[model samples]
Target: MLAKIIQEGLLNHGFHILETRTIQYGTQIRLLEGAIINVYRTPKVLVQGKSISASPEQLRKNLEYVLPTRITVWNLM
Candidate 1:
């Protein structure tokens, strides 16, 4: 999927990536780009949506706050 996305993007913009590099610093994993990105995730957090219907569970896990059993906060963001 990543390769397809890059290929399509380059094609759409009339720009070609004639070269790819594997960027690796050390075993600690500092940064990776292009071909090297396959080794590490490019995103830190994945946020899809937010809601207020499941807040009780979320708050309980996140803030350790107690919420009534009947209350929930679904992802709505």
Candidate 2:
């Protein structure tokens, strides 16, 4: 459910979906710009990639649209 919403949101934001795989826990979506989105069944989403931080405004907006009010950002540097 969440995965489908995210896929549609990203696509509407002009992001090209490179690949999609159903993992053991949930769905993994790979984007052309090197961004990987992992939507887990536990209502937790893990977004990784250098491009994510520097992505366009619309991309960020799409993320915010799906995210809950409480968000935790970790600087995995």
Candidate 3:
């Protein structure tokens, strides 16, 4: 239920849901371009080149505290 709420909140905030990746550690919610959110025992979102560590209360706030940067780095192969 918490995940659903967070997903909905992110959606409302104009954050494009790219894909979800699951690993041995936890779940990663991929967002616009390269923004990746790691939600494990604690929540840490990686955007641009920085990572924002968030609390449960902060997560409930629709990620208002997270200020993500653009995904400028790309693979030109």
The number of the candidate with the highest TM-score is 2
Which is the winner by TM-score between candidate 2 and candidate 3?
2
**Superposed model 1: Cα runs more than 4 Å off:** 25-40, 44-77
Task: State each model's CA lDDT, in order.
Answer: 0.29, 0.68, 0.47
Clash counts for the predictions, in order: 15, 0, 0
How many angstroms is residue 27 displaced in model 2 relative to the true structure, after the best TM-score fit? Answer: 0.3
Q: How far out, in Å, is residue 28 in model 3?
A: 0.3
Worst 10 residues of 2 by lDDT: 68-77
lDDT of 1: 0.29
1-77: candidate 3 lDDT, tens digit per residue: 33455567678786677776674555667765334565443333332312234433433343453332231122111
User: Over the stretch 44-74, how does candidate 1's per-residue lDDT look in tens digits?
Assistant: 2111233233443442343212212232232
What candidate 3 gets wrong by more than 4 Å, as runs, is 42-77
Please tell me which predicted candidate would have the highest lDDT against the true structure: 2
Taking all chains together, each candidate's TM-score versus the true structure is 0.26, 0.70, 0.48
What does candidate 2's lDDT look like per residue over 1-77, in tens digits? 98898888778867789999999898988877666777888877777654644555545455566444353232111
Model 2's alpha-carbon lDDT is: 0.68
